[model samples]
Target chain A: MAVKLFYEALHDGLEEEMQRNKDVLVIGEDVGHYGGSYKVTKGLHEQFGDLRVLDTPICENSFTGMAIGAAMVGLRPVIEGMNMGFLLLAFNQIANNAGMLRYTSGGQFKIPIVIRGPGGVGRQLGAEHSQRLEGYFNNVPGLKIVHTSTVYNAKGLLKSAIRDDNPVLFFEHVLLYNLKEEIPDEEYYVPLDKADVVRSGKDITILTYGRMRYHCLDAVKTLVANDIDPEVIDLISLKPLDMETIVASVKKTHRVIIVEEDMKSGGIGAEVAASIIEQCFDYLDAPVIRLAGKDVPVPYNGRMEETVIPYPKDIVRAVEDMLALRV
Target chain B: MVQEQLAPTKYDPIDRQEALMLYRDIVLGRTFEDMCAQMYYRGKMFGFVHLYNGQEAVSTGFIKQLRPDDYVTSTYRDHVHALSKGVPPRAVMAELFGKATGCSKGRGGSMHLFSAEHNLLGGFAFIGEGIPIALGAAFAAKYRGTDQVSVCFFGDGTTNNGQFFECLNMAVLWKLPILFVVENNLWSIGMQHHRASSVTDIYRKADAFDMPGYLVDGMDTLECRQAAIKAIKRARAGEGPTLLECSTYRFRGHSLADPDELRDPKEKEFWRKQDPIPKLTKFIQEQGLASAAELKLIEQEIRAEVEDAVQFGEDSPEPPVDELYRFQFAEDE
Candidate 1:
């Protein structure tokens, strides 16, 4: 076993996949020699040459569309965005081309393309740079969405994503990149649509994924001290949502609190809450609650940032509110 | 005398055999579109049908010069491109009818025909969307050590889209083997050329990429073929990309539902006179290449071929309802 950071694991996974498959290529701005803005693709260009690891111009929409086209013609392309904020320029390609190609083409074409970039707030990054777009992509059909919380899962999940024959939105949290974890020293792949149970409990279900997953676990630890046993479910894949896991969690706990870093209104948490209400309404002991970031631009100040984003205290308060409902 | 030299009176010097094939394919596309328009009005096929009526010469002239392995991506007005790229007439007609036997298994209607066998990549409904995709196809072909070029066909209206400029820049910068064909059909929907663009000339738009751009008479099938052959050859020779602006017209409206009363009767008259099939027929006869009776026999053969295709589509079974969820997610179990 080796101690790997989320970025390292992602790098290793991509490098191995590219070396194994000649059809696999990497395309993005600063992805070649500079090794990406986040350094996730560091040293790849030197190792693979310019052909396998390409440095594209600052044209996200065109390059993203190009990646989809390459994928259609038997190439597996991994398009890296400098940040999720920059992905706005590429929304047209992703939503219209990548998300609709397979269906529009009646399955004549397959897009084995992965668009990777860091999402969620970190440090003092201003409003534009700190947005979370998982909700936006998760709402789009014909795409697989994945967010990883640890190095092992990131690497495994990325490998699985590369091998997947569908277009995928691979969201990597900026804060989780440097966080180290033990990764198995062997080739492994994780299934795309299965949820991972972080901690099992019967009192309340804390549903979340990505960086929020670690925070939810921390909140669970705190809740345990208060004699509140919360079941923490890490939703690995947002699209192709494994409602079976959420429904089962609600059945066991009878109360749910969805914690997400994205804003509350029309967020992914709202969708999850709606699904629970629609499917698991009768079984719920208390109404399903959501703990998410406030609906506003993520502030640049560290003090305001901590208060603006969802934290363990918010999770604890939401759980206490559910308990009050039971009384 | 200037016209003779510029247009090249001798088709032999430019490869006459290839020119003949192009003419035949252009006729085939024109016949197919004419039949579709007639059938569409009779309610034999449903939904939106963007007829490539006057644009036949551009598709036929362009696609004839491409290798079978070369990729062709086109816009919503794409029947001519699909036909020229060798997609079966039966499958295309079935697609227009929204039947399972259609090119895209009935999922895609007229605007989204796709065939991997013939390398007809797809026809994107969104304007200018396929340009970048064609560039990527070119990138892949080059990466695979092949000399195949990818042809991206779009209307003059798509020139305003950012995707078009962005793809053109990338294609030139990367030296991608891409041929951007602008089928300037005089108008986009009811909107005319002047209202929609700063410069009505489509070739000027390609100048921004520092690439070679040519403006040709789209109604002249031989002119279109000659231009496309030069562009495709340059691209295949690793000379990067070129843009060919075919000044064409769509005799039908944007879709089957559109009634083109917005166009001037005089402009329409001017284009009608330049209709490619008749022009090519006249050229073939005057050159004594084919007799009038022989050409009439060819037209009869084309009509029968189209009739058989229509019958084949009408008789084909509809896709089952269970197939609704099919091809939705490619990665899942």
Candidate 2:
């Protein structure tokens, strides 16, 4: 085992995959010589050469669509958006072309492309740059969504996303790049559409993903001090959700609190809460609570931005509120 | 200089066999489209059927220059493009009928025809969406050190899309082997090109990307074929992409449901008089390539082929209900 940062794990995963398959390539703006905007793809261009690690012009729509085309013709392309906020520019290609191509083509084509980049609020980046648009993509069918919270899951899930024969939207938190954790030295792959139980408890289930997973873990420490045993479930796959695991967890705990970085309205928390009610309605001791970003654009002020998104304090308070509720 | 660049370049005269081949392909396309229109009225086909009526020459001319391994992507008016790229008439007809035997297995009806075997990538429903895809295919060919080129066919309105400029810039910058063919049929649905476009000349826009641009007479198959030869040769030789604007006209409305009342009668008559099939027929006769009886025989053969395709489509079964749940993702091994 070796300790590695989240971004290093991602780079190692991509490098290993590229070496294993000649058809696997990376394409995006500054993915080649500049080593990616965040340096997650650092040293890949030198190692793989320009053909395999391509540097494209700052045209998201065309480059994303180009990746789709390359995927159609048997190339497994990993397209890195400089930031997930910029993915809005290529939404048409992602939702319309890459998302619908397989079904539209009647199972004749398989789009094996992974679009990955740092997403969610970071260090006072304003409204346009701080948005976590996973909810928008989660609504799209024919797309598998993955958001990892640890170096292990990040590397394992990213490897699986590259190997899977589908278009995957892999969202990484901007803040988590520097977070270090020990990962296995041997090659490993976590299957898509499965959730991981990070902590085991009985009083309540804490459902979250991406950057929220870390905040929820931080809340777990306070919950333990207050005699509240909360089970933290890191929802790695957003689409084709591992509801089986969630429902089982909810049934065991008899209460749930969902956390997300996206806005509260129409967020993934709403979907998970609805699923819990539908699947295990009778098992609930209290109504499912959602702790998500406030329904407002992220402001440039650092303190105000922190208030808008969920923090460890917010998660702790939400859990307390959920535990106090009566059936 | 832009005007000079748009002028048609001269080439060697087409031989008798090649001319006949062009005539046969165009005739086959027309025959198939006519059957599609008839089938739509008879209620055999569903959805908006965009027939490639007068624009046969554009697809035939450009596709003739492409090798079987070369890629072709087209717009919703794609039946003729698929036919020209060697997709079986029966498969395309079956697709329009939403039959399991169709090219896309009845999932992508009239708007989405794909044949990986023929390298016909797809028929995109949205305007200007296929250009970048074609560019990517060209990139793949170059990355693999292959001689194959990719051709993207779109309407004149597609030039207004942001990706059109973006893709053109990248295609030129990367020197990818691609041919962007704009089938400028004078209208995008009900809107006329001149009114919607700021600059009326579509090929001239290619100059902004520093790419070679040519405007060809879309009504004449021989002229379109000659221009396509030069463009394809340039692409295959790794000289990068060419933007070819084939100024054609669609005799029918945009789709079968359209009444086509927006066009001026006089203007429509002017283009109808330049019908590409008859123009090619005249050239064939003047060149003494075939007798009138031989032409009649060819027409009869194409009609039979169209009838066979219709029957094949009619006989094919609809996809099973379980297929609805399939193809969301590739089946796991």
Compared with the true structure, all predictions reach lDDT values of: 0.86, 0.90
Q: Taking the tens digit of each residue's C-alpha lDDT, what string does model 2 give over A1-327?
A: 999998899999999999999999999999999999888899998899987999998889899999899888889999999998888999989988899878878887889999999999999888888988988898887999989888999999999999999999999998889989999999999988899999999999999999888899899999999999999999999887899999999889999989898888888988899989999999999888888888998999988887998889988998888887754
True contacts kept of each: 0.74, 0.73
Per-residue lDDT tens digits of candidate 1, residues A211-246?
Answer: 889788888787899998989999988887789999
DockQ of 1: 0.69
Please name the candidate that would achieve the greatest TM-score relative to the true structure: 2
Query: Cα-based RMSD of the predictions, in order?
Result: 2.5, 1.6
| DockQ of all predictions against the true structure, Cα-based | 0.69, 0.70
| Residue pairs with clashing backbones, model 2 | none
| TM-score of every model versus the real structure | 0.96, 0.97
> Can you tell me which runs of candidate 2 are displaced by over 4 Å?
B1-10
Instruction: Give the CAPRI rating of model 1.
Output: medium
How well does candidate 1 score on lDDT at residue B255? Answer: 88
**Candidate 1 residue lDDT tens string, B1-333:** 011112534343434455456666877798898889888889987777888887787887788878899999998888878989999888998888778899988888888999988888899898888888898899998889799899999988899888888888888887889999899987989888889999887787777778877888888877877887778888998989888788888877788898778988898888888888888878777776677887777778778888988998899888888878788677322
Instruction: State how far residue B17 of model 1 sits from its true place (Å).
Output: 6.1
